[model samples]
Target: MTQTVPRASATATPADALAAGIGFLRREQDRAGWWKGELATNVTMDAEDLLLRHFLGILTPQAAEESARWIRSQQRADGTWATFPGGPADLSTTVEAFVALRLAGDPADAPWLTPSAEFIRDQGGIEAARVFTRIWLALVGQWSWDDLPNLPPELVFLPSWFPLNVYDFACWARQTIVPLTVVSTLRPVRPLPFDVAELRTGKRPPKTRTPWTWDGMFQNLDTALHAYAKLPFNPIRKAALKQAAEWILARQEADGSWGGIQPPWVYSILALHLLGYPLDHPAVKAGIAGLDGFTIREETDQGWLRRLEACQSPVWDTALAMTALLDAGVSAGDEMLVRATDWLLGEEIRVPGDWTVRRPSLAPGGFAFEFANDGYPDTDDTAEVVLALRRMGKPDHLRIRGAVDRSVAWLEGMQSRDGGWGAFDADNTQVLTTKLSFCDFGAVIDPPSADVTAHVVEMLAAEGKTGTRECRRGVQWLLDHQEDDGSWFGRWGANYVYGTGAVVPALTAAGIPRSSPRVRRAVRWLAEHQNADGGWGEDLRSYRDREWAGRGDSTPSQTAWALLALLAAGERESEVVTRGVEWLCARQRPDGGWDEDKHTGTGFPGDFYLSYHLYRVVFPLSALGRYVRGGS
Candidate 1:
């Protein structure tokens, strides 16, 4: 069932580009029959890895030097590090990187530290950093524990129905904050190698006098919590800490990661170590070893460099790559695809995790982003994997049928009451916890998003489930959420480009005609926003400001996304389509793949961004293959 139709009157066949990209992707596939391109994030991960090692008293001289080298290499010309490349200088990232480099024995008087020190001080210094940054400072005895907002371990006692309960958080933040509660309660501080006075702005932050707002109320609440922390031991404190530890231990994946992400894995290990779990404890040892797998080392122009990734993305990359390959005419029955399907089938989650709390009666049947993480299976990844399976053209295969049916059922049950889908849980949209001062970084709750919902709807439509009530509800949600300008919000991806691109084709496949007024409006929006370079791009800033969405210097991946949307709307013969295709062709490298330095994959919108190395290559291939296939 591989698509092979070629468009007539084409300036040139995208077959060459598609074939070359496919061959490159084929070589990139692992021996286990899956693909995993590097999931690159910012220097914060590398800096934090060194900081974690320092806290555990296990940092080797060799390892420290290499990590410092990598951190220093990421420094921008203004001598500050950012959360993402080509983004603004981030105060928190600069502070962490500076502290890490100083711990690596980079001299206090080194010229490289001067500009960064100035940047931090001018930006309001260490006190102006995020709550998470302040927590790290407190860990190394650089900041006092009293300065941090309180997160009582007693929070473990809160039932699911209680306000600000653990279940209110998005899975990623929930895992990180749970252990943080334990750490904040213990308030352990290790001696530092040196003071960070040079990074300080020398100005005390003015206390807020406004009493009616989120900041004011959270400030008062934190004051009360802090007072409680100093009171005579309550009997529940012991039981609460014990509950927190047990909660963490129970969620450890088979690979030893808490949630297959850096923050939770690192914090959980630290929290346990403080509770007298030695470095060699089974859980502690496994957690540390699991983190090592996320490190990437390679030869750089300056020499060998080792960087740490915030998380791994095997299941995600494999699904996207498989679909792209099929679009490029790889036979559905190809041995490679069969092997991939077998691998994916083996990965289906049968045991419930945190997601079960939201949908207690829902059956276990979804996939996690990592090889482990059985505790949290995301709807986004599960939907994409189903699409990949369908693209493999195996309708009657027993294993595929079973996995798809279970996943579809899970998706149906996990849909938000709003008729959309969130990343992990059902109806996980509590805005109260996000108002807390400690949650100053990003969205703490996982609300239903346009992009994830679109993928699920698209998958169901492919399976002929569009006639069902569940699919109809999902379609309605997408229509309801469309922006005034016809774009949709991409909660998981970059911005409007990712969301609108995902929604158009999904709606088309779900029985909405491509020429429908709503669909045509979306098509017009994309056409009007096309960059002068004939491609499309969006900045990470778009997540913070609506004006920035669907606007930036052209990138291969975003261009491909727009092209796919246009193709879905029957615009394959349009001028915009040809120009977009040309833009991608002109940008392909001699390696038979595209070169995109922009970080297209979004981890947490404005706070964290990802440059999935394969996205630049994989998505472009899919676009070209579809172009050769005539249209979606």
Candidate 2:
């Protein structure tokens, strides 16, 4: 006997919702045949942009006000800015936003400023913010440079085999750290026009003793680095600075940004400037211009607002859109799909990048998340890109086959020794790197994740390599890492629901039976966690607190994620899945899309979150299409 599922009355039928979603995607497609949604993060992007302009001495009053308008709009009623929607107040984000507002000429004693300043003091003031936040304040003379940790440029000269070498850090952290070593060594301080004393409590937080621990050891190391910074004559330091500058310059992308992300982009400009590169220098000029490209400007009810994307996701979004379209019954031979396939083929990376530091002999062939991050083609994007290409039944078979072959070889070579795939470099799991006092923010190392590994396993299985040793090992790895409650942790998405969703389909594709204990447990977990409204959602807090796992208000993308797993697990006729389908149909907008203000993507797990605007449409369309087709 099948379990009964309660039905909710929906304005649109599943078929109607699918058609509307497909049409919405078609209308949103670019002339070049791709789709990209707005990648929204917290106010730090806007706050940091203002500070960068002030440091470069190019901040226009209009620009400041525009950015400030956007920043001010993000503040919560408590006068604090959380990293994500409905999350707790973040001291660092609140501090950064308050200072940026002050820089925009918001009077310190003003009604809005008073609440923010009070909140900062209550949270232990500027002294309690993260290292990166303090580093930003130090740049502007608001915080003493001496109080911060020192990162020597000499660390760049460490051999690859040595512990804590530059390559040991994640690609994102590596990019930011190299230039920061120079900035810390030069220690430039451009004083702000006004003081932020109101945001400080004037009393230092008490320190705890832990002489035998990793934190204690790294703290001692930082003390030595500080002493080294005070030296008058150090011949090796001069050579290290030269080498570090060259390292930064060599890695600059074609668009003049480093790694196509904000941290590195901003720090590289500052480091180069201190190393005597004039503002007019081509590298510096292009760097500034590239940032303007990342800037999103729009007219709102309040006023014209400006904000920045920490990174872009054109290739990632385009690949996902293609897969969604195919799942929604769009013909593979459609001109729209052919154009997308062609564009993806053109974007493939065929040359060496930083990943080669470890796999030096491995040939390069993969896709990156952004438009021009050739230096870092990730496994996640490459896996999905291959899956999309394999689905297209167009006339460009030979070309697509060659690219797919290269990507398979590249991905296999990039797998970690533990038989799993990380987004970037393989075996980049140095625990000591995260223990460093200077590395006290977001993930600093790329480690194999269940979600990424699941995609690779699914792609390989789709290619008929299910019996290969690599595929078998990846399957075992996923089995070995499931949570006690039957879910997997999603390193790149929101908590357990995302992880379980990605894994269930991949396991079934790789030949795991729906009746397998692991699959059934995951299915039960999803069904048990269903929201009262018949949809699914998981909070970003699940990354930090287990109590929140698979719990939150319903979201379109997350609900679709759950449905995809159930549909793949042979649950097409189950009441639980029927309810999920009905929930999506009832929520469909007239234009065929859904409204989702909450972030469904993860950047740094607990520290950062992302809102992929396209997710609300693409995912639901795929789910509803599969449902209407009776799980295909």
Candidate 3:
């Protein structure tokens, strides 16, 4: 699931660019004939999926209408929406808008419909929808599911330790595939529980690009996964499925959901339903109702950002914001710090999760992304937040500071000996378990990504805790990871750009010299990659496409990172520095905001991207805030 992005792939045309992107994606499809990447998990997808079901008679007309009413009510005024502030009008959003309008019974001229449709059409029409979207169509027989890569129900056979086994798949995929195996094998089109015949154009678009066959290694390896999938399952495989089901079911939280994420929830719904749970069963009903709660409402002059799903990251967000503001040179004890700190205090996660299993030696409590995500957030944010607070030049409220200490202690115990930190727990390093033929995921079991480990290192240094045995190990790990190009891979951000940006500053803070070869090489990398527009960008493709090498259109946040790296290296007058700074100034929203745009936020590099609306503002502000202060 993890990949080191290489250089850009050459594409003579936009058509070629997209063709290559999709083609590259196509090859990743499983033998199950299903293509699932990061599960898009946004409100738009949920909303539109409901609408599609309704329009196509898969759900009741009344249900469809009700959902459409809810969706229509969430739009903003600017005729466009960025999932995050100053972000872009996601094609997924546009597609959802179109389908929702159809459910609303809007005539073709419906004011919003026209603009939304235009946007959808412009973004490559139906074809532009992600492979997952197409997979949905294939399910309804609107598109051919056969066209899907074969997903034999038999992958149920592989043992966890074997290469290509189910454990190789991330936790998310593990939950989904168990059920998907049933669905694909059964391949039954449940009766439309409502009418959606009106939305389609009635034809698949003409072939637009060349087939995307790579060095053909994947093409061949794919054969093994597919072959194993076809093999008969012994009792062991059946028992594995039983274990997987129980595992998934037991993990479902009190509200009847799993993963604090939508994709898993959706699949859980499908899985249980197939397991003979009726539509009205309590678990099924709860799962269905949970979908309704996953929406957000923000009316503005610009278009509404009906985020595919509401954020489940309050704890994560609050912690990161506190840390980011502090990094921006904000004085400690400022109102922002106290407010964020207070929020973090109240939001500590008090339960155990997968991290607990991977590290039974650690304590039971862990944090979640949001106060609600009580599922995953454990060490990453907590560790970083502790670092942020420990370094603050302010007094913490007694109660809050104590909570921070508990959090930090937990992180210290969670550190891997290499000094690099994994996000949730320590010693969870069983990558071999998930690489089986049954696995189909981007999340590795416990691999330490550079971005995350670097954040931990920076946090330690900020607290003047660097050079300790553990911290030094983390530093060495970072040093070891530096690419020949000087950039390390960013695990949480885009790709190399984000990794390099973070690595350089942390190393410098640890007292790595500006002239150190590592620092100079990173500086050169940043300088060389700086865009003409003064900003920086690495496409989502960087997650899966080494050729794209994480390079792409410039955005404020990426530009800021580039600037931050160069700035840390004391590259004040570097030509790259000037252009990057200028780009930020020019792109500033008149309201002192940057576009709620620029895909700097990282999801699993390729399958999903984030519109960190705040990035447009927070980062630009950080860079600008520090820069305009008379060059420090």
Question: What are the candidates' C-alpha RMSDs?
Answer: 3.8, 2.6, 11.7
Candidate 1 scores a C-alpha RMSD against the true structure in Å of: 3.8
Model 2: how large is the Cα RMSD against the reference? 2.6
Tens-digit lDDT track for model 3 on 1-632? 11122213322232232233223323433432222222123346546457434433456555555556555654555344334333457665655555555645666667866666666666676555654555455454544544444454445566654654544555555556656665554444533322333344445644423335432344445455455555586565456556555656776765566666666777667666666677788877776766656545344564433334523555554554454455455566665566555555566666666555445666644355643556566566776567655655445557656666666556666787666777655654665544332233245455677887877777677667786776788889899988887888887777788888778878887778889999999988887776655577776666667765546777767877777788778887677776676666655543444453345666555445555554554455555544544231
User: After best superposition, candidate 2 residue 264: deviation in angstroms?
Assistant: 1.1
* Ten contiguous residues minimizing lDDT sum, candidate 3: 1-10
Off by over 4 Å in 1: 1-12, 393-396
Provide the TM-score for each candidate, comma-separated: 0.97, 0.98, 0.69
Give one digit per residue, the lDDT tens place, for model 1 in 386-459. Answer: 99986665644877888898999999999999999999999999999889889988779999999999999999
lDDT of each: 0.87, 0.90, 0.58
Best by lDDT, which number? 2
Top-TM-score candidate index: 2
Give the TM-score comparing model 2 with the true structure, all chains together.
0.98
Error of 2 at 604 (Å): 0.6
Give the count of colliding residue pairs in each prediction.
Answer: 0, 0, 55
